[model samples]
Target chain A: MDEARSAVRAARRSDLHALTDLRLHFLGEAAHADARLRLMPDARDRTEHALPVWMGQADRVLLVGLDPAHDPQGPGADNAAPVAYAMGLLGAVPPVLAAQHVGEILEVHVDPAHRGKGLGDALVAILGEALIGRGAQVLRAAVPSTHEFARARLERAGFAPLQLELERSLDAG
Target chain B: MAATFASWLQDPARLVVVAEEGGRMVVGFAAGVVLQGNGWQIPARLGRITDAYVARPRRRLGIARRLAGRLLDLLYEKGVGTVRLAAAVQNEGALAFWQSMGWSDLETVLERAVPVEGRDPEA
Candidate 1:
């Protein structure tokens, strides 16, 4: 609600620690909601390892939402931290018919306390801009079918159902 | 497309099966590839059926089913324990086909186009 005290910007390498925390939080929530959800038990370690490479890549987009009221000194300050974040990757779309690029929103998370303040919307919008700048024609996101809240949030952001992915356990046979 | 097909045909991890009528005219084809699953869960080899098509006239002749079965056999020979595929929500025929073949519903992939123009001149 305090527009003057909140800001959203590209995440820096130093924000890796905060981003990792948020990623873990998101994964925890997802796994709690769905026992069938597949998540890395070592998600924190993987995020820490992958953030640097993602930060340095031009085709990758990472944005963090900051509450200046927490720490105005800037992102690396001891008290400064990201309350929400979004990450996306631009990928070539199989070069079928016409060469095209697609942006996949790999992760988007907003701290529970930070929800309802439109931070999630701002994060996705900025990420979409970044992807569009890099020649992405379409944006894709995969939300767990059981997560109605997440699905509604994406729909509010203009996403629509594209395809249904079906899988079967071959071990049953 | 021909070049892409040729290249895939050369990849040992990829399986491409084609059904030909009269031993010359191609009637149907199926393609799949083997992939390694991420280590988060069970470490299993996965197979994905990327594309399958049978001529419209050749649809009910069992060409598509035969091609798909052969492709699955090849993927199994390559050690793939799981297989996955996607079907457009509007394609009832395709959905029914996969479902009848014993594939279970997994997840839906949603998409949206980023507004290319209008709104926020400054991003």
Candidate 2:
């Protein structure tokens, strides 16, 4: 691969298959770091159905990162497959909290072969901008406690530990 | 606090369970919302424990333990396969209390303040 590009664009309905493929890859990789992320039988079906609707929502965003390095026989590089993706959602905390409005970064994933090329950073930046434009005062993300690499990436972007979530199986409840 | 409880009581998705031990007064409560699991991580429905409290004097009578068990019973019976709750890192007591009930560390929620357009971080 030569001349890596970090260009990104809003996802279109045509990108549904690519988005679903990347989502499963993200889940598969995450399950390695945390045993809880089992891909359900309906994972593919749920995501495919959710993406098109999300892409058009004003408070939600789906972005695709392009890596022209692998665009074959193309002059404009429009056919380059999406090598990275990031989804953002605007939400509000419970009315009890002072910081009511917030933005959440969900399911951030980049192709393994395309790492270390600033593609992930670019995608995060774009999503952050989009979320900010929609009146999000705080940006939030959650990652497996053992996934240090992902945590470090967000930390470098100025994220700090706000809270810790704990869970356990229901038998003892 | 009363209004907050009232709001939760009004919302159909929110479940507010209170414990009254041996008196007409309320002693403690556990509240949560029925939410789907984050992203596509877990296929089953999720119940997020939004608030839990037991009066100081009511501690260690196994009141909290029993209350938590009851809360989980209702959650799981309602189709929630996983339950999660957030607590401040400094709240070691809360952490220990939940740990004693089989809860363990799952995820860390990270946050960043968005820079105001006209403000400078260095300034």
Candidate 3:
């Protein structure tokens, strides 16, 4: 557990390739957890292209967890790849009350092999700090209603339920 | 309010409809935006009614309904395949209002305060 916690850190520009793979993995996990989720064929390509832009943004935060014991073989090896990642964006809400800035957790995922450790909590803590540093007064996340595990994690991490998104098909009528 | 209205007016993906009395005084307004569904189970373009307001004096006159109807029509004309709106759970009047207009409950939004560091959690 300690090893896994230590492996987590803020994602850097050099981690783009690993970040892209982790994003695809996260999408697959999301789909498997919910039958309603359908992965776009170009999701991988889009993630690869968008990661750099999102990472470069001042209002965005991305954190990654690496395999604690990963040792590079020589060259072109799958060394130091991220085992998990969490991305968030800072946004401004309509001027209400004393708080205006809100931080939204856009996506978070941990590799199957890295489950059961405290890596997820570590990532959330780091990201929360980053968001607070950026002047966010509140943190928000929209977890899939079907993803109970993810929802549980967020609840345990000091996030409270925000809104229920109900949807119906217009084509039904 | 001015900046928000201006931005919404400028966004091509959004539609703003206003009900005016005597062609000058604004009585009510409805605003909506076209949201592309996340390629999951929801693949169609969605029209989300972000805000709708009707003057209290204009209540029961169907001005709000007319504004919403026109907004929906414009959204559908723009190729939106679905429409949705959210109302506070405690506001039974608003709920009934939307229901009467053919909008059904979708999801309830829950909000939680972020606990400040070093603060008492129970507080």
Candidate 4:
């Protein structure tokens, strides 16, 4: 496949490896750019094990972007391997506020070779739409301050800066 | 708000605390919740300061600080490793207040509105 050809769809069981591959790439890139996200020695093992269980979850949506070069009319239409992936989780804020169901985009990644092909934008748009179909009234994504590309990607996908999350690590009590 | 309070009061993993004064008047309140982490990405148990509010008349009176301290202590008692909270960028007072209480900026949360109809993306 030369370029991604509108082949994005919700991930299936058969797409587990593909999903893990693209997601890991995003995490790896994140860790490379930010020291705070250092990976442990067993990071790959742990993530690999958790991904399959995550794939089976009903409250999460995982999307895959395939390189649609295989036969379009036969069972091989979707046979091409996935070159990108995006995921979202169904969640809600505290009910004290005007509580509404939310879909949070946790990660979106396209393979390096697939970059600049608009695959990332396609994944986010479709992922957001999918989450809305599943009853999400609002959508949110948290991006690190240093990652200009990631933030720009979200902005291009229609996300606007909403809130700043301040954090403090507490001593165990 | 009443329903939410009632539900939080009945949940074990949630912490709801309020400061009272003058024998019966409620001056401030704080809320925290614990979450089960996936162990790989996040810690096993995490805490979040979902809401914290103090009456306008009670501003800078240490009521919110005391409430926040008590709420965080309760979260620590539950074995949480870290705690987080979000405040809108425009809420300078709230942000500064949280900073004084020891929280610092960590992440930027972006939001998008999903229309009720015609959400199907053509791309």
TM-score of each: 0.85, 0.86, 0.74, 0.82
Error of 4 at B115 (Å): 3.3
User: What is the overall TM-score of model 3 with all chains considered together?
Assistant: 0.74
Off by over 4 Å in 2: A1-6, A68-74, B1-14, B36-39, B57-62, B118-123
lDDT of each: 0.78, 0.79, 0.74, 0.80
Writing each residue's lDDT as its tens digit, candidate 1 over B1-123 gives 999899898998888999998999998899998987553432358789999999898888888889988988888788876788898878989989988887866656778876667323443
lDDT of 3 by residue, A100-154 (tens): 6777777888888878777787787777767777767677777666777777777
Root-mean-square deviation per candidate: 3.5, 3.9, 5.3, 4.0
In candidate 3, position B59 carries an lDDT of 93
lDDT of 1 by residue, A1-173 (tens): 34512467788877888988898788777777755455656656777787888899988888888763454455555446788899999888766577667888877888998887777877777777678777778888877667777778788878898877766556666
Error of 2 at A104 (Å): 0.8
lDDT of 2 by residue, A1-173 (tens): 12333367888777788888998899888777778767776778888888888888988888998774654346756666687899999887766768556889976888998888777777777787778778777889898888887888889778898788998777543
Q: List TM-scores of chain B, every candidate.
A: 0.91, 0.81, 0.88, 0.88
* Model 3 C-alpha lDDT per residue in residues B1-123, reported as the tens digit of each score: 788789888999999999999999998999999988654334458888888899898899988888987988898888876787766656778777777766654333334455567222332
